[model samples]
Target: MKNLKVNPSNSLKTSRLVIRIFASLITLFYLIAFVPKLIQMLLGDAPERPPGADWEGSMVTVSFLIFILGYIVTWWRGLVGGIIIAIGSILMFLTHMMSASGEFEFLPFFVFSGPMLLCGILYLVFWWKKP
Candidate 1:
């Protein structure tokens, strides 16, 4: 083939960097939030609560897919995925709160919800700020 190369400009490079570093980190965090449950499930244990297990798994998987799609598309959807994660976290918290004998603990909430909120903020600050 003849000499032909498609080179992305400087801005494209910078955007890619943001998506890979910021978006991907957030996505990974959200994914990690599910690992304890996922590990339990893999070991034949059910979640203490089950409303969002499947949804959370799907969201984590989709967030990873969005990172993969970054080569072709913007990683903006990771922000949306992060929002979904946060909502799921809230719903789970509410369900637990409404339970007759549930206790409120901060670690679970922080691990799941905090990363998601941060993900949204990072996306807004890094990506949405300009576009």
Candidate 2:
């Protein structure tokens, strides 16, 4: 009989690569969208809003920052970073949902949180399967 065996470490490496690429792509997309606003704010050229400004936008930004932090950390530690990414994605979704008059919207989630949440889940799954 022919013998065949699967090496778990190779699968783990492949999964890790996939998770890293997915997270990197997401981080790149986010940075492309966010860096301009960040630069504008840093340059003190952001448009001034009226008093009692939009707290929702600020909250979204905070959540987005947390997501970015998870992306950075994922390179170092997949398990903890995945947890952070999940939390960030949940916060991002809820914040945007609140800003949309407390209505659940699929479009916003697809655009912002869905891919990130998927990536985070993938990370955790692969981590758990690691040999």
Indicate which candidate wins on TM-score: 2
lDDT tens digits by residue: candidate 2, 1-131: 97888888987898789778878888899889777777777787878642124787777787788899988888888898999999999888887787747778888899889988998898889878877
lDDT of candidate 1 at residue 24, scale 0 to 100: 59
Best by lDDT: 2
What local lDDT does model 1 show for residue 89?
A: 44
Quick one: how many clashes does candidate 2 have? 0
Roughly what TM-score does model 2 have, to 2 decimal places? 0.85
Model 2 CA lDDT for position 48: 60
Model 1 Cα RMSD, 1 decimal = 9.2
Q: What is every candidate's alpha-carbon RMSD to the true fold?
A: 9.2, 2.9
Q: Scored by CA lDDT, what does every candidate get?
A: 0.51, 0.82
State the number of backbone clashes in model 1.
0
